[model samples]
Target chain A: MITRLSWVSLLVIMASFRFTVDPSFYPSARSATQAPKEGLAYVAGLYVGTGVNKPDFIATVDVDPGSPTYSKIISRLELPNTGDELHHFGWNACSSVLCPNGKPSLERRYLIVPGLRSSRIYVVDTKPDPRRPTLAKTIEADRVVGRAGYTRLHTVYCGPDAIYVSALGDAKGEGPGGIVVLDHYSLDVLGRWEVDRGDQYFAYDFWWNLPNEVMVTSEWGVPNTIEGGLKPEHLRDGYGNKLHFWDMRRRKHLSCITLGDDYRMALELRPFHDPTKLMGYANMVVSIRDLSSSIWLWFQEDGKWAAEKVLEIPAQPLESGLPEILKPFKAVPPLVTDIDLSLDDRFLYVSLWGIGEVRQYDVSDPFRPRLTGKVELGGIYHRMRHPSGAELTGGPQMLEVSRDGGRLYVTNSLYSSWDNQFYPEGIRGWMVKLDVGSGGGLSVDERFLVDFEDARAHQVRLQGGDASSDSYCFP
Target chain B: MIYEALSALIGVFAGVDPSRGWLYAAYYRTFRGDKWFSASLVVVVLSTTTTTLLTVAPALIALRTHFYTGFLLLAYGVNTLIHGALKAAYPRAHYSGPLKPKLTHLAIWSTINSTLSGYGLPLGALTLIQAGSQPYFYLAYVPVVTALATASLFRGVAHARSLTLNYDLILSALYVAVGAYSILYSLSTILR
Candidate 1:
C-alpha cells in the first residue's frame, strides 16, 4: 500500500505536468478589480540625460504600506548594455493565459523589457524572489530583425499563445512598422504578426478586445523622424495620423480611420478592460492646427469601426519660460503621451506631458468624459514642486493604475531624444504615486515619492496585475 | 519514382498547414467517439482511393512519355509556387471563424487538394514502368508512407487533447520543408 505522503507527492508531480494556468490570471476585468492589491511596482529607470554611463534598469519599489521599506527602491535589475532607452515593458504571461485556446502551464513570472532605441529585448525572470529579478535572456537586435523584419521595438503585450511586441519601423528603421511575436516559454522571436498588413504602415501602440476579435493599433513616426527628436516639418508631413483596426483572430488588417491630417501622431490606445465592450480610447498626441491634444472614442458602428473625438485640451498660452522647440508657438501644447483605463472601466487617466499635468476623467460614459480631478507638478513654464518640497522636472508621461483602481503611479520620461529636445535642461527622472479617492478625486501621496537622482523613468507596472497590464476573455 | 514520391509528400504537406492541421485535429477530437463520423471518414478515404485508381491511374499511364514527365515536374513546381504565393498574400484564406463555416471550407479545400495531387501515385508507377524499374524498388515506400502518416495523425490527436504541445509549429515546419524539397527536386529533374 502506498503511503499518504507518497500519494500526495505523486499528485503534486502530476499537477505540475498538468499545465495549470496562473492563479493571478483573471477571467474578466471586473474579477481582476477584486484581486489583491499589488505590493511592489516596477518602474523603467533610464540614465539617458544624466552624465552616468550605467545601463538603464528596472527598479522594484516596495508599495505595501505596512512594510518598513514602503516607497523605497528595494532592488534594481540593470540591463547588461547601456543606451537601451527602456520605454515600456510588460509581463510575459497575463490574464490572457486563461483565454480559450491559449497556451497553458505558463506562469506570469517573467518581465519582457524592450529597449526602444537599441531594439534589444530582455527576459527578466521575476520568480523565486519577485523583488530580486534576474536577467534570464537577452534577445539581440539582429535576431529580432531577422525574425520579424522590424526594429525600434516598443510596447509588449502578452497574448493568449504568444508574447506580442510592437515595433516602430522596418529593418532599416524606416516606415511600415508592425508587430513581432515571441514564444511564451522560450521567449524566442517567432516572426512578424501581421498576415495582411493592408495600407497600415506606422505603428506605435496596440490593444485588443479578445472576445470581440478586434485589435486596434495606433501610430507614431518612424525611427528616422522620432530618433532625432520631433521636428515641425516631420510633424506636418511625416507623422502618422491614422488608427488601424485588425481582425485579431485572422491577423488581418480590416480597416483604418484617419483622424485627419490636422490631428497628427495618433498614439497610445486604451481599450475597454471588459472583453464584451467593443469601444476604446485613442489619444492624438498633438494637433498641428491648434497645438492641442484630443482623445477619441473608437467603437463599432454599422458593422464597421468608427472613431469620434470625445475630449480636447487646448494649449495653454505661455508668455515666458518656453523651450526652444515650442518657442515659435509661444504656447505649451498638451502633448498627451499616454493614457490608462481603470480595471472597472470607470475612470481614464490622461497624462499631459507638455504642460506638466495629469488629469483624471470620469469615463463611466466614454462618450462624454467629465473632468473630476487634476494634479500639476512639472512643465515647461511652471515646474510645480511636489508637496514634499522636492523639485520635479519632467511632466507626467506613463501612467499605471492599481488593480483595484485605488492608486495611480505616474512616470515622467517620454523618450530619450524627446526628453532632451523638450526639457533642454535635461529630465531628472522621477516617479510619484497619487491616492485615488473612493468616488472621483486625486491627491498626491505626500509620503510616496521615488527620486531617481539622475536616471529618467518611463513606464510603471504593478506587482501582480495593473489596470492596463492584462486583458480579459470574459465580460 | 522518387520524383513522384516527393510530389506526393509535397501534396500531403500542402493539404494542411499549422492552422488547417489544428482545425482537422480539433474536428477529430470533437467527434472522436462518434460512430457515424468515424464510419464516414473511413468511407470517404476508401471512396477517394477507389475513384483515383479507377479513373486517374489509367489516364496518366496512357499519357506517359519522357517529355510529359519533364512537363509534369515543371507543372508541379509552378503550381506549388502559385499556391504558396497565394497563401502568403492572403493568409486569412484559412478558416478561423465558427466551426460550422470551417467544416464547409475544409470539405471544399480537401476536395480540391485531392483532385489536383491525385496523379502523384499513378504517375510514379507509370514512370517506373517506363524506366523498366524493378518492382521491389518502388514497393519499399509502402511501409515508410504508412508509418509517417500514422505517426503524424497520432501526434495531432494527442496535441488536440493537451494544448501545451505546439503541434502547429511542427506542422508548419514540415509543410515548409516538404514544399521546398519538392520544388527543388522538380526543378532539377526538369532542368536535367
Candidate 2:
C-alpha cells in the first residue's frame, strides 16, 4: 500500500517530468511535418509612408518555390487614412495550438493590423486568397477610445477568445496604456484586460510561457511623447524601466522586475516557444546617454520570475570598418530592437537596427546564448550594397522565422518618422530572406528579395506561419 | 440636478468605496513599496469613476417610462443579433455616423453598443431603482431618454455635416490629458 505522502511525492515528480520533456526538448527529424504548411506560398509586408498618398498598406509578395513570378508583388491592400503609421500586426489564429475533439485544425486566418499613431485596426481575411488577402474589417481607435479607453495601438496578438492589442496611451494619447481585447471573429471590442492600473506604464510588447503560467510585457513612453521624437529627457525620466509579469490565464499582475536605469526602454520580448522552458529574451533600445544595448534573459526560478543581463552589445568603434559618415558618432550603437526565436527553440535571431546586422545565437542552453553566425546588411550611416549592386538604405528591424526553422525573413524600416531621424537617406522598400542551416548558420538568398523601391516596409507575415512573439505551443 | 447628485453618489459607492479595498489588496500584492501605485490608484479611481458616472448614468436615468425602459432593454438584448445582421446585410458600409468619415463602421457600432448595453442599460436600471417616488422617477427618465434620442439623431446629422464641436473635443482632450498626466506622474521618479 502506498502512503499519502509517497503518492503526493510521486505526483509532483510526474508533473515535473511532464513540463520538462516537451516536444521542444527533443530534436525531431526536419521534415514536412515540422512545417506549418507543405510549401511557403506568400509573404505579406506592411508598407508605411509608401506610395503617392503616403497611406500605409499591406503588400503581398509571392514566394512559391516553383512559381514563375516568385519574389514579385502580387497584391496590395491600402488603408483609408494617409498617416495611420502602420506598425506591428498579427494573425487571428496561426498554426500554434492543435484543435482537440475532432475540431478544425488551426490555420492562418485573419491578419490583425494596428496603426501605431492613428489607433486604427484592420482585420484582413487571409483565407479568401493567401496571395491576395481582402480587408475583412476595420476597428477605429475612436471606438477603442470610447469603449476600452486606450489609444496609440502598438502590438496585436491573438489570444484564445480575443485579439489582444497593446496600446501606448489613453484614447487621447496618454501614458501607461493597457491591453485592449477584441472579439476574434467579429472584431468587436470586448474590453480591456483586467489589469489593475497601478503604475503600469506604457505597454509595448507582450509574450507568454504558458506552461509556467507566466506572461511578460515591456514598456515605452506615451504615444504623444514618442511620436514627437525620443527625447533624452524621456530616458532620464525612466520611461521603460520595469518589466511586468502576470498570470497568463487570469491576466493578473504577478510581479515586476526593474532592468536598471541603464537598460531603460525595454522593447521586444520573445518567450521560448517550448512552454516548459519558462525563459524569454528582451532587448533594450539605445539610450541617448548610453549608446550601448543589451539583451536581458527572463526565466522562472523557485516559482518566481527573475531577469539578468545575458549579452551586452557594445557600440562599434571608429576602426570597426563602418561607413565614414557613421564614424563621427562616439560609437556605432547596436540598437538591438527586435528578436525572434526559431520554432524548434534552437536558435535566437537579434536585429541590430542601428548598425544593420542580424546576429544568430544558439540558445539550446537558455542561460548562455552563443553567437553562431551574423550577417551585416545596412545601418544608420553605412549603406550595405545588395546583391543587385544597389545600395540598401535602412537597417534590419522586424524579423520572422519560418515554421520549419529553415527560412528567416527581415524588413528594414522601423517607423516612418523614426526612420527619417536615424537613417536620413530614407527606406527604399526591401525585405531579404535568409536560409537557416541546420548548424545555426545564416546566408542570404539573392534570388528571393522583395523590393518595393517606392514604398517603406515595416513587418512581414507569411501564410500558415508561426513567429516567436505570436504563436502558442500546446502542452 | 438629480444627474449631478446621482452621479456623485454612484461615483463614490460604485467606484471609490469598493475600489479602495480591492486596490489596497492589489497594491499589497503587486505594488508594495511603490508609491506610484497608491497615487495612481487614487487618481484613476476618482477620474474614471467620475467619467463613467457622467457619461453613462445620465443615459440610464433618461429611460424612465415603461416604453423607453423596455425599448432600451430590448435593444441591449438584440444588439448582438442586430450587429451580426447589419454586418452581413451591408458589408460595404464601412463607417457611417456623426463620428465618420473619421471613424470606421466597426467603431460606430462599438461605441453605440458599449454606450447602450455596457453603460446605459445597467445604469438606467440603477437610476430607476434609486428614484424612490414614481412621479419623480418618470420625470427623471423623460430628460434622460430625450437626451439619448437627441444624441442618436445628432450622431447621424453630425456625420453628414462633418462638423465636430470644439466643446466636445475640449472635454475629451481635457479628460485624456488629466488621466494621462496623472498616470505618467505616478510613474515618474518624483512619486517613486
- Give interface RMSD, every candidate, in order: 14.3, 26.5
Clash totals in order: 0, 6
Name the top TM-score candidate. Answer: 1
The CAPRI-style docking tier of model 2 reads: incorrect
Model 2 TM-score relative to the real fold: 0.64
True contacts kept of each: 0.00, 0.00
Structural RMSD, model 1: 13.2
For model 2, what is the alpha-carbon lDDT of residue A472? 43
Look at candidate 1 and tell me the lDDT of residue B168: 29
Q: What is the TM-score of chain B alone in each candidate?
A: 0.48, 0.29
Where is the poorest 10-residue window by lDDT in model 1 chain A? A10-19
Q: Candidate 2 has which clashing residue pairs, if any?
A: B60-B124, B62-B144, B62-B145, B94-B105, B95-B105, B98-B159
Quote the positional error of residue B181 for candidate 1 in Å.
47
Per-residue lDDT for A337-413 in model 1, tens only?
A: 89999999999999999998999999988899999999997877568889999989989889999999999999899
The global Cα lDDT (0 to 1) of model 1 is 0.73
